[model samples]
Target: MKILWFSNIKLTETQMSGSGTWISGMNDLLSTYYPDVQIANVTIAKVDTVREEIVRGRSQWVLPKKTTAGDMDLFVKIIDSYHPDIIQIWGTEFFWATIPFETICPNVPVILDMQGFYSSVLDVLYGDLTMQEIIRCFSIKEFLRPSSSLIALSRRLHKSVNREEEVIRKYKIISVQSNWVKGNVNLLNPKATIYETRIALRPQFFQAVKWNLNRMEPYTIFSTASMIEPTKGSFTLLKAFREVKRLLPQTKLLFAGSIQTGIRKSGYMRLMEQFIYLNGLSDSISFLGSLNTDDLIKAYLHSNVFVNPSYAESYSLILAESTYLGVPTVATYAGAMGELGSSKSLLYFSKYDYRACASKIISILTNRELAVKLSIQSITFSEKKHDPKTVAETQFSIYRSVLGQLNK
Candidate 1:
């Protein structure tokens, strides 16, 4: 079988973001397990450069000439040349780009991976912003800037949010990472065929890491995100950390994610820095500034607990990774995080409640026996549910089922 995959981010740039890592990991799994299958991956390029290359053992990769309006023609020509059995578009942000596919590849089955619904995400991020602020934040030029990729992507996605029922009706199937996302998809396209496929941890995360329950860095709390966006609730985390510090004076909060510094500093970054200074947490809070997977694992290893203060998530990949690494976790009951922690392995608190969040973190940090129990439970759950082989097999079955329905 042949498959053509479309995503805004290149699989080669997997280390940069969450969706890229997911695409890269899934592609690797398919290549390793289903050797006979032919896969073509087409990604939007950052610059006005085109490349068609065959990696040593991976799929044929096609990067668009550019992300401009004129590049759509070149992208469609590449798709036609591949002659794929099915087309899988990774997210709804590419709805405009995929419109031509319906007429060009009429017989080919297309599957839309509902990574997350843009409307739901926007509701969380801009929930507090006024109409003027929303407009100012998402101008047309911002949507075209490659430097602001996430915002640009979100802007495009927002355009299609109301039209999802009409747009998704064209696809043969929809794949979602979690039941929470499936719920959102159902609301958008009730008739759409939805498949729930949980993402697996990368092989690196599955490796055995020693869980030092007895000897951990004193009162160290760790958290990570791809970027310090408003949706990530970094401010909420800071507030919660302050409460935790009040209780335990020696506690330190370590953040591992990208932060724009210097002149290019974002307004949010400035606000965070001001908050830290105002709260007199300069010494207790530390920003690691975007660690790679290996370093992230090390952060999880040294920390006493992991905290997820995000306002929403389709699936908390970092939470799963931290749990697998054997850190007792405390998270807000937002989006699919509750589902991920359904095994009751981690402590849960109401979203945006700083005191409650701090209380939960304190419980985990102060109680060694409770922390050890939660850590063991989390590790066992991650190993069983996030096994790479099991995930690959399940996804392969879903692909086969989609193909079978298309044949019928």
Candidate 2:
């Protein structure tokens, strides 16, 4: 079987957005596992490496004018040349992706991997966009029409929107990560199947050096995620860290992220610097700018605690990565993050309360024995649920099942 993997964003080796990571990983895994299946991807050029196929198009967020219809028409021709049995679209909101599939490849089953609610995501990514632009950014005109199937990253996300109400009569499935998706899917669409696609740790990540070194410092806390400003809750983390610093002067807090000046300057970064300077924490507070994955793993290993303070999270991949690195995490109870933590997996804190948040960080930092115990349990949890080999196998099974259904 041949598949045409349609990406919503330009995916390049160096540019690793969450959706881009998922797309590239899926492409590689599908190609590796399904020997008989061939896959071609439609993507924007990330670099000048291969000028082989350039489909000049405009992005709503990046470009000033609507992409020429002629350019998109050429894109369809390129896709048709691939002759795919199925078309798997990564982002559901972009009309450009759906238009060609609907008009040109109607019989070819298309799967919409609604990575997340695009409307909510747009607001998070581009707060400067007007309400009208936000509405235009994620119009459901294309997806609301009947499609072969719709896959949501989380069940709560599926229920959060009203699109299912309009499309369920024709919608085949809305799969989530674990059993939690099944209950919500049944409630949302009694006819829909609740499926699991587990998140995994890449084997390459295992090569990170593990530091089980004993430290004399009473507490060292660390947090890491994409540097995007609105959604990551860096503000909440900074506030909490400020409190922790006040209570325990000896404690060190490190904020690490992969962001440069051009991208959305995390408002928190500047504010954090001010807070550090104002509070005289320049000695204890460190802003470790983005590191390679191996270095990130080292950060996880060396720190006594990990924290994810995002306002919303589908799954805190950083928390999972930290768990696999045998580090305890303190995460907010947001979105699918609750699944990542058990009573023993990591500490949980209310979303906004700085005092409660600081308390949890302090408790984990001070209790060395408890931290070690949580680390062991967290690693076990990660191996069972977030192991890459396990996740790849689960996804491969789903691909086969979907293909089988299409054949029928």
Candidate 3:
């Protein structure tokens, strides 16, 4: 079978984010197991002028700007040339990209991989910020160039939000990573068929490694998020870390993700920095912006505990990756994280309660037996549920089922 995959995220060898890891893992597994199947992974790149070029050994179709009719025509041409048996579009964020293909190939099977909805994300991220604050945050041109474009694109996509019912109504299958996302899609289109699939960790994370419970870095904690957003609960983590530091003066926090700085700094980031300064956590907290795979693995190995204090997540790849590495975790009962790790493997805290969060982390850090038990359970859970082979087989089954329906 020939499959054409469309995604907004650029696939690169050095990519470290969740979406990047996901695509890379899936591609590797499909190539290894389903050698007879032909897969073309396509991504869109912004260019000064419109053209097609091979970027980093992958086909990148360049568009002059966001969502244009010309780009849609080019995509249709590519699809016709490839003549794929099935087309899988990665996320609804790029809903505009899928419309033309769906229109042109009415008979061909189209699968929509629902990687969380943008509308739900906006609702959570902007839940607390006022409309004025929202406008201000998006208006900072120099610092928020990417964000500004995102906001503009979201507005254009908003028109399709309600129209999604009609678009998805025609699709034979919709794929989601977690039940939480499945629930969201059900609300959008009740009759649409939804498949719940677990995301697998990369092969590198499954390598044999020794877990040293007795020899841990003294009072160190690690946490990671894709970007500095209000919904990531960085401030909540900071508050908990401050309390933890008071109880154990040697406690240190290491954050491994992109933190906005300079004039482009978001309000939440500024607030977090102010809290750190006022509480004298300048030396206690460290921001390690965007680590590569090797460095990220090293960070997880050295840390005594991992904390995930986010307010929401569709499915947290970082949390799964950390737990798979046998690091004891303390996370909030938010989004699909609770679904990812069980109470036996992960300790859950109430969201936005710094004291509660801190207390849980402290309990895990102080009790060596509990930490060791949780670490073992964490590995056990990951291996049974999140192995790449299991995930690949599940996806392949879905593809076959969809194709059978198409033939009928």
Worst 10 residues of 2 by lDDT: 55-64
- Angstrom error at residue 307, model 1: 0.8
Please write out the lDDT profile of model 1 over residues 29-65, one tens digit for every residue.
7777787777777766644567776653545554544
Per-candidate TM-scores read 0.88, 0.74, 0.88
Clash number by candidate, in order: 0, 1, 0
Q: Flag regions of model 2 displaced more than 4 Å.
A: 8-19, 31-35, 46-72, 93-100, 118-175, 178-194, 209-218, 225-228, 258-269
Q: How well is each residue in 149-239 modelled by candidate 3, as lDDT tens digits? A: 3355457447656555555656667898998888877876788778777686676787747356866685899998433556777777787
Error of 1 at 356 (Å): 0.8
Question: How large is the C-alpha RMSD of every model relative to the true structure?
Answer: 4.0, 8.9, 3.5
Q: C-alpha displacement of 309 in model 2, angstroms?
A: 0.5
lDDT computed for candidate 1: 0.73
Clashing pairs in 1: none
